[model samples]
Target: MTITQRKPLRPDDIIINEPGDQYSCDSCGCDLTHSVRIKCADPLCEPGDGVDICPPCFCAGREFRHHKRGHAYRVIEINSYPIFSEDWGADEELLLLKGIATQGFGNWKKIAEHIGTRSKEEVEKHYNEVYIDSQTWPIPKLDLQFSVDPAEFQARKRRRIQALNDTPPPPLKHGPVSLPGIHEIQGFFPGRLEFEHEIDNEAEDLVKDLEFGVCLEWDGDQIIEDEEDLDVRARAKWEEERRNPPPPAEKGRIPGKGPMINGINGYHPPSENGSVATRESLPPKSDDALANGTSSGDGDEEVEEVTQPPPIETKESLAFKLSLLEMYSQRVDKRLEGKEVMFDRGLLDYKKMQASDKKRSREDRDIVHRLRPFAKLQTAADYEVFAADVLYEALLRQRIQELQQYRRLGLATAADIDKYKSDLQKRTLTKANHRDYPTDKHPYRRQSSGPDPRRASLVSFGGDSEGRKSNEREATPRLPGSSTGQGPIVRKLPTPLNLANSPSLHLLSAAEQVLCAQLRILPKPYLVVKETLVREYARRGGKLRRREARELVKIDVNKTSRVWDFLVQQGFLNIASDVSSNHASSSQDASTASGSQVNGSPIKDPRPLSSQQNGPAPVPSTSSS
Candidate 1:
């Protein structure tokens, strides 16, 4: 549609909500709660008491309850199946479809596994993509069948499970074990061991009620695919676990100390006392040695040594208060030992480490301070916990940024991410290095990835005058005379013409550039019109319109998004016309032929572009650009 005529089909084209709806608890018609509200009924459609649209109505408006089309169909087609079917139109097999839709599109076995279909064989089984979406362009055959040897086996009925799913449970390591020196501790601990072992039917149960992070596997290596060093670091974890196991207790029990449910002397209590002797073991033993020098086997309790300070009477001074706080910390560490503790202790330890390392702890403290403003907690202590989570995350982020900087500067090793991650994890977890430090990928990691549409306006303004100036630069090169071959040589630019004119235009995110590529305006020359399109969109409807067509210069026809669509014809493209040529048809064709314009003029539509159809790639048919 031309910029002026570019109206949304309806006031709200894509209604985010459903008509009348029950998202969950269908039996009671209870709304299925979600972190985010779903489009219950379409926002566009209204259902009512003849006019009052309910959530179910809006949710089921059109899209939500529709029999979903699997997105992989673009690459999974009947490579060359003979036309013989019941009533079904021939399309790609689901297996082929799913494979090409995912990452590693050409791996046959993986594809088969993905689609729950048969995988590759000795022969390469190629498939074509068959899109059910009439609006969506056909995705070309992305080769999805790699022959196997030292390769992943092509999926068969027997192997329905993917690598990420269906892992065997570890052996139940929940029994007692005699340990040297540990036996003394065990007497007090008196509990079941927590050796790393799996429960029976754990995987089987997950197979039925699978939620996220259901399975863990040892895929030739531990699956810490988030970064490198996981394999080496993973071993360090088990070594520590093996070396320092808590003394094993009886079955269905944990030992030594913890919350009330377990330990006899914990905060949350069975009255702060563990199991009572079952009418058998509690009485004092009849042996003489038992009553002698051996201490009661109730775990080691530290005896604090007392040193009296120089006489302080009545009102204890600030020095005394400081001493009290110091005493409190020592007491906590003595009692709490190895486990989760309060933020105050953790922060103090963090500061101690910073001072020891000669690094300013204030940077880490500042991070916590920044997070303090966003804290959901009401109390100061609770906010400190919140601050710790923030501080740890911030520190990790800083490390990751440093790693990324190293990568950019070409100083990065394959180990940079993992090494830096290890450093951050050590800082966060403190002495506990066995378990993982969380690795999170930010949706908007870099500051520069986002766009300012006003910049697009600035771009529009800057380009016209600058484009004229560039035109002047090109036409009047470093020439002494108009016709002389040698005054000063006119050098060819390494980059394209339009790029030199506006370098800022190219400084967009890859995703943004991909959006621009969908507009098929690589090395864009028409900034004025594009900026106009953006401004027109904004003026018409701020976000909705702009989002409809955001970054235009690098739109890739193949990708899908809120921005540019391939379903509706772009004003630039000249598709092979489906309509037959007749006098009336020809006239309309001529108008549509120039793409809502007349005689290929800049009259309006930007049609008959250089290469709209048959774009640069028969590239791996990506679901996204």
Candidate 2:
């Protein structure tokens, strides 16, 4: 096999060449136009005009006088590629700019002609792309000089002032003023300044043939001269007419006639019998008589009334009014045509439209009512979406309930539920197995030989048998001499028992025992009264009055009063700081009495003494008083 070498590629082969390409390579002296031209990237390498080299020179790594092989280089291919559009050429862009400068902007046809290579549309688009849309292009700033001439400024100011002065004052009445006969024109929209069918639809014909143009001779000087001449002529004519007044003719007479009646000018002569004719007697004028310029009344000096013709309108004014009316008529006709087409197509059927509107309204009302609870949802779509979500949630809740029921029945298929049931069954079996083993931890689990009579009887009763049995056992009558076998025997002693042998008396102090004996109160009753009085004293800020203390002890008022006196005498109750000053001597005496009674004997039975002696027992005088 023979080995063949491939030919080297040229820049022109990759990029199409254009006529405007002018760049040249410095190393090989080759035209760099329409090809990739290499330039030194270093700014200091070549200051203004950088060295350019062809692609071949760049590939060969050839060095020039100003550019070196080591220096970084950038490639430039002028006219080889388009920046915006592929079809546009660089020369065409140059032509576009030249055309804009010569023919001015907006003259797209002339610009396109100048740029013969591109059409007007392409030229306009290219210009806009480069100048308006592209940021790379620089925009020229205009230096506008604004100066107003003194004479022109003064003239403008004067004209403005005159215009302000000429402005009409506001009317006294200010409101929506209705024009007379405005309602006669059907479909007349004042806001739009248009009307329906006009009264003279053919008014445009009047001015159709009239041609208008500027008359150069009608300048200010000519107008003023004409006005002056017209004024002088009018004055001369008025004087001549004033001097040339016609002579008065004979009343109600015509030449070679008897008395003329209703002759010319509708005048009438009087009757020959010297009777004044009444207006009712005069015959009315007929159409023929009016056409012939004559009247019907017969009198000496009376004239019949005649209607005058209206003033004639100018051609221009009449045409303008007619044209406006015609335009309105055309508009009305066009609107009617559209309505007629709609009616013909059955789109404007009143009954069908009304029914459809009512159905739509009913559906809207129903939707609004149904969505009233979800008022936060602004749009119908939002409401519908939310309602669907709610429905889905309800389905999920029902499914969850079904699953829960399945789980409760132990028929669930879920792994967790099955695992839980298995675990529960295992725990139950394990407990049963544990019970069978009879571990020491649960001694009650030991099997009994047989059911007890009490348990058997309790099982036979449906109610709380244990509670009933307990109540019965507690209610069982016991002899006073008998004792319960549970613990120590506690005897029920009489209230008059000696305090030394009383179980409750040992808990009291010596002074409390002595006080109890003196009051003829049992140790229990004495302690109860003492606690009540002390609570009342503390509640009243440590001050217990005699009557208040007696009220607090509800057991026996006389015995409670004695106990209160004993407690007060022993200084057990003291007045609060507020009343302590008044009870200073009493407090001092009670303190001395309490000190002496601290060593008193234990309580003795006071019940027997109270029963034997009717008089009050003598109390100890422990205080100094």
Candidate 3:
């Protein structure tokens, strides 16, 4: 080897130059000088930067793109070596350490990607040399002492163990005892069966035998006597017979027996002394008490007629309640009076019942004839409805009467009077107008009313034709949720009778009946007069004389005469005067005008005084005589 001076190449020159001056192109095999030759830019290549390339390799940006983009090249000049920093800076070293920590050692490809500078091989070599082979780590050693006296160590170990042993053991904790399930218990004890298998098998065999058993010989006598006795029906019959046996032959014919002595009384059947017979066991009629007698010789013996007294009436009595037939009769009477039947008729055949020549079959005709005598001739429902109607009509009439009285006294107006009549019609008459016609034009609007062309004389029910037309004009279609904008005016009727003095007042619903007893009476003398009338006569004891009653109510003698006269004229009190004597007044009857006598009917029209018929009149006040 001759001693020759060689110039060092720059990093850029080294990056493109081949190892030798003249080299074959790896791609074309052309011999290349340093100026024309370049190395492959891939750092991971086997001969990194040593492979020779020609200028053609740079065409179309092949080496300049992808992996080789931004790669450096060398510029040759006079002899000058490249200035390169081979040692890493502090930041680079830190990056290298962090990359190793994250990517781990020998993962050079990933470490290189992270560090962004070194090749994988370079990174591997650096990491292995710096961190593995040449590394000196500071590992702290624990300064310890294991050497000890045998006796002392043994004593300390024993002492520690003794302390642990000396600590009192925790009290034994008892939890709820969990019992095993049936199957679990059976499984645990394999020899034992869960149920009585033999008993079950026997039962199953018995049931099977019973299902397909031998036929039995019929023992009629045994069934009739022995087994039949065990039957519920037979036992019940036997018990019944034991409880109520037949009467003794000696005591059999007790004449004039039972409640049938009077046919009007509740008919009881004939039986033993203690037990009464059912209707089926009663004897047939002996042609005596029945209306049509068959025996001719028995005409000479006068048959005693049984008379029944009227039923006892009490405070709790419903006896005064009218039968449905009576209600129907009352309705017919009212209908004949040329007035609208003041009640709901429901589905009643009132027209058919009234018509004499109405078509009907023989049975229906017979039924109608038979029922004609009874007010309860129709169905129970018809009767119920009829009674209700009569009651309702009666109350309506009473209210009408009260209204008339009120009007007479100028306590109520004509409009107020009309309202009650309208309400009564609405309640009683089903044919009354219900639907309102639209004032506005509507497709389903009610037809406007006009006189029928066929009829020369127009007729209307209850209300007059002109009033009906007026009503029709006012009628307007009501829409859901729309306000009528007019509130109904309510008026109270004037009560005539004091409820406390009336005996049958309890029949009316308390909510409906106005207690005149509690009314706010005008004129202090009027109240005193009423009090005196009620106390002296209407109260339990007996009637009082006029003088005593006037004194009791604390009215003056002259005022008494005026008040008494007023009461009598108003039909509040009934007084019978004595024409025999001038000074002494006869026994006065304190009649509160509670109601009418027919069915304890509601009060009819109250006849007010002639003087007060047209307008309000001042209460008569007699001056001191």
Candidate 4:
């Protein structure tokens, strides 16, 4: 038989034969159940309905309309191997997921049918073992149980809608309505309230006299007019003036044919003619004119003539002028009332107020200046309240200072003052008794014979002679044993050695004191011996044998032996036993050696030992002396 070559399995060769596999390749338009499906993982590429590709198309890196080769892809294999349980393959897990998603979780029979191979009981058992009972489940399980009441929900919804409907709309935008008297002072017009004044009030003056067609015209020397004009000859002279335009008026001068009445350029003194009346020259007003509240002139006539004639007064203009005058008089009256109040309060005296302010402390002025900015923002009522609070705070601070003063004097109250006086008397008596009977601890305390020199010097002088006498008294010194008055005699005794005052003994602890007592050695001498041994031990690299210690303090062997034994027992000195063999030989040789002598005679050991143990005496120079 000829050998047949088997084809190698590609990644696409893993075919998922599950009936639940519904995904198809988007590119080749083939069912994905025969091969592994690849899906575009990019969130932006066909996000709602994801693009899926078969393994063959994916391996070939085919690009669809929305999916590109560069986009990340996720491999979806329905026939993947077992994950949580060996008996359940990935295909069965997928089917179980799909069935639960469609039919809900507790339908075991339907899930088994979807899984195909597993029975209902087996499927339920596997699900419980892998997901519910085991800790390996991927998603956390929540036992949240809640129910909604549709009636209550609907009631709440209706209430919310009703509340929204009942809410009022915002107010409409309009110009602010001023209080009755405010418009006169602020020049605000109530009727035309859009702005403070009419825009371009003088614009009408420019075009009021303009005519659409010329009423008169001139050709050569003859004048002409429109055919509709009945009085063409009457307007002929008027048309000549309009054509010439009077050679344009001079700068800074009004365009007029009349001569200036005064010497000043462009100035016309009020006319002396009775028809053109000046303000000062107007005839006295009649009762009817005054009752009508009209000036002394016809409504159309100019009351005063100067460079230009003023506009004829209308009812509105007269009313506005009268309101302005009334507002001015009211302001004047208010000012007068304020002045009277200031005079009554003596606030009108500027000089006195300034002097008083100058007398105030710098700190007070600084506080006022600092508060001025904040004061400006406050209303009258707010400012009054703030001022009251400030005064209260000042009163509290004053009370606190008084309390502190009383405390410093040891008399915070009337009862405290009585108690303080009694306590002071008792303290004085105790001090006198202590001075009379001195303690033994201070035997050599200086006795006061005369009055204290410092106190004598501090005494007030009655006269020059008395001051000189007090100075002479303070200059004199008293004998040591002599009494200032009939006081008891205090003898000066010799002071004893205070062990507490000893500097060396201060270094020893209670344990060291016990060891020192057992060795019959004073703590000072024991401390000296310890210091010497410690220095030698450290020099010997932290190892000291008994033989070396004995040789180091050989002056008085008995005392040195006691201190050494105490130090060794207290763990201060560590004697190495490794040199025991050499130490024994050295001891023998040391015993044969002569004793150390201060003079010619050899020193003798006070406590004799066996010849095998005896060596040179060990005595620290500090203790031996």
Candidate 5:
């Protein structure tokens, strides 16, 4: 191969570049050689000297007019998908379309019509950015029935029929878990069968090294905005369409499928040899089968009322729990133990029942008139085996819901709080690396370390939340942390458990422990009052009573009397100096003479002071008294 080298000219030959920068040509293939301070506007041109042309061609002068209007274009509004990211590109639009398209493959023709773009090829080429008329997402008034992609959609339907032969998902409690990250296929699913099949097959395939794939569902008529009128309308439309099922695509037409039933909590009928009969073909729901009761949901079928068995005494709770579950499983839905419903031994459903008195026979007109009222469960788990108590079970359920919600909303769970906080702290530290906490090096106390149960929850929850997840293998640690095995981690015990040693005091009141903790955190000045001020504040007849002192102990507030001033000055009161400021100020004003006099010389005031509240105060010489 021969080495090729382009001739280099003086600085004039090359154009220097800065970002937010551009240059362009008069024609598509043109270039410019001359450099100019002005910004180039032609899209086809490259930056260079005054001669505007394609950077390579370097000949045609700039032709495209610059559309500069001084102020940059303000994106006051945009039309976008609600779920799409702020920087959503064009392919996302197509992906979103594929997800929501109702017409299937034929819908591609309307791509230009919907977005006002020129052609399908153009639409795909410029998929990164889709300019919209509105600055913010606008919900279009036009209706498009959403359907699945023809190719994959047909494949999914075929798979669904064949999937009846596939194994069902494992139960919620155990077996190989269908964790979102480890085993899940992201898809636009229609019904429970499709969803569960996807989960089971995808999870198995996932573990077996099958790569993840997308299951896009679309056509436009997906989520109905008017949900109150949705079910009835969708059912009517589905019935109409099902009665006149569309012709095969060889003649060039869309398939008339019924409304989506996935992601809903509803009754599912048994499938026959993988073919689901059209609802139109099925006999109308019998009035007798439904007890002629009113249905809260918009659909025609009324809900069946159920009579619950009487509550059992706590004596045989374990047997009662099993009986109740069995009854509940069999009560309303007989098809529940159907082949599809029952998973293998590890495939048992981790169902929980909560006690509720709301009648299944009630005439409640609310749209969501309770579907099924479960009896109130005493605790989180269904079976409160002697092994798992209320606290442990509640903590576990709380952890699950918290994690699930956090995962769904993409937020930090209580489990991640500490780790997140540490990360945040590190980021903040970077901004102030040289900054220091003045007392860190000193043997000082922390004022912020006041007693708080929330603190205990935070510390305990933070260290142990990650382990609470269902996938977590090890048993939940009863103690605060893995390190707790060696010994109690005093620092992590929340506010030092300062009163934990004082059984009597601990029994006295939790309020007191909290108050004492606050007191421990406060400086001596607030507790100590000057002798004169204390007498004045207390009134002569009121001498700081023992009850009063004890009551103040909760707040760690002290009367600035001879007793308090001495204790404070002697450093008997331990807290931040700012806390003792009140006592110190009072002591300074009252003078140390009062303490000295009480300690040394016998003394009495020459004039007796009296207050309206106290009546008359005595002034006696210590010598005589």
Candidate 6:
């Protein structure tokens, strides 16, 4: 029986009854025989509250809950039938159903919006409980057999391989592939398979001719059976054409000229009909000639070979001559330039060498001045001691050689005797050379007397003069008993003769003279002032410069003070002071003095300072000595 439809059926339509069924659902017209019924308990059947519904409408809560969304509906006991739990009534279930239809499964927020009173979580829970968890349909079982039987292995393997080979390769991905959604609702919809099949068929048709073909190998050197083979007659025909080339055409030949003239001479200007003759002389059109020589033709006149004259002997090309001249000039210029640079370099080197020599000389003089006192302490004895081992070894070897010669001969040979004598004399000279002069002794062993040798060397001109004089006198020969030789020669001590008044200072008692001389020689400031003053005094001729002396002693400018006062008090340095006052003390002492008069400007004390006060003296010696 067909039911007349006035409107499109929704999910509620499927739940409705056939046209003849009784005890039917009011919303869907379904019979309540097997379906559970939702009968309203309110006594308001004519007031629209007693309408009944089938199990689907009750479970899905279609029009039943749609109409009574604001009202409460209570369940009444009916004949027992399969029923959904009443805990989630028609409203909640219907909301879920409508929500799924409108918004699809996962979007529960909007689903909840359609499901007003229910939360998205409650709707999801109810749907999961009813449709997913309590689902009556079982999941299709996958009968996967991971282990194959050995007996069937060959058949199974062959089938698998054949399937793989027969399977078409996947279509080439042109760009990015759009994958179908795993949870897509469209898969559950009807007619989707038909749409998919239509799309695949159209795609196959478009790509059918675009498939890649099988690949094969080829070699160019091998001739294939499909190529034509030549016969002997064909080869003969080719040779005959080559051996007898066609005679020259009229246009190629000189017009109005015989064959003899054309053969001997090369080309001549064409006659008046050259254009017409050229067109006519072209080879006839034929299949064989077109295939053989269609591209060959004599359009140009024959060229005669001519012997060329040897190139004329002329002066070199202007460009080449100019280039050679420029090269030579550059060579000469470079030579001169290099010579000039070398000369300049040599001159610079010479100037540098001269300047370096001058600077080195100045440095040497300064070094000598600084180290003079220390150098004077090292006499020849120190050098001899340093080389003693070498000298001893040399002498020992010489003696041994002499002994050996004498033993071999049983007597000393003249050459060996002479060598031994010469060695002895040489040893004596070596010892003499090694001796310290003025008194042959080591500097460390000798006793010292006199001022510091540094001071003596700088200041005591008188001592050096006396030593020289004594040396001269000692060098003169004398008879054994001369009066001067009878006793130790009496030598007068070297005083500053330029500053002495008389030689009779020995007339007074030694003590008194010592006091007077001490008063004359050493000033009060001598120790502190010695180093600077000695340097300055040497700058002067053993006389102090008052201005330089003031600067030298100027430790304190505020005090007028001790500066140069010692030299002034001793009357040794002539400063701006009364000469008579400087001499008064000396004159008064001179009148009361016992014998010799003391000169006011006397030289320093002649007697050497005690040797025991400082270390030993260096024996006097020149570096050469």
State each model's CA lDDT, in order: 0.36, 0.53, 0.42, 0.54, 0.36, 0.43
**Candidate 2 — what's its lDDT?**
0.53
Q: Pick the candidate with the highest lDDT.
A: 4
Candidate 1 lDDT over residue span 529-602, tens digit each: 34555455456432222233434434422222323322123432121132112213555433443331221111
Ranking by TM-score: 4, 2, 5, 1, 6, 3
Clash tally for model 4: 7
Q: What TM-score fits each model?
A: 0.14, 0.16, 0.10, 0.18, 0.15, 0.13
User: How well is each residue in 588-619 modelled by candidate 4, as lDDT tens digits?
Assistant: 44431211111111122345457415432342
lDDT of 6 by residue, 6-82 (tens): 54335532311121123677787866733457775544443654667665776775654445523345554332211
Residue-wise C-alpha lDDT for candidate 2, range 315-387, written one tens digit per residue: 6655675676677667667665554444343433446745754765454445545754563424545655775
Tens digit of per-residue lDDT, candidate 5, span 358-379: 4322332231233212212222
| Candidate 6 TM-score, true structure as reference | 0.13
Candidate 4 ranges with C-alpha deviation above 4 Å: 1-17, 129-625
- In Å, residue 242's CA in model 3 sits off its true spot by 99
Of 2 and 4, the candidate ranking higher by lDDT: 4
How much lDDT does candidate 3 score?
0.42
Model 1: CA > 4 A from native = 1-362, 365-574, 578-595, 598-625
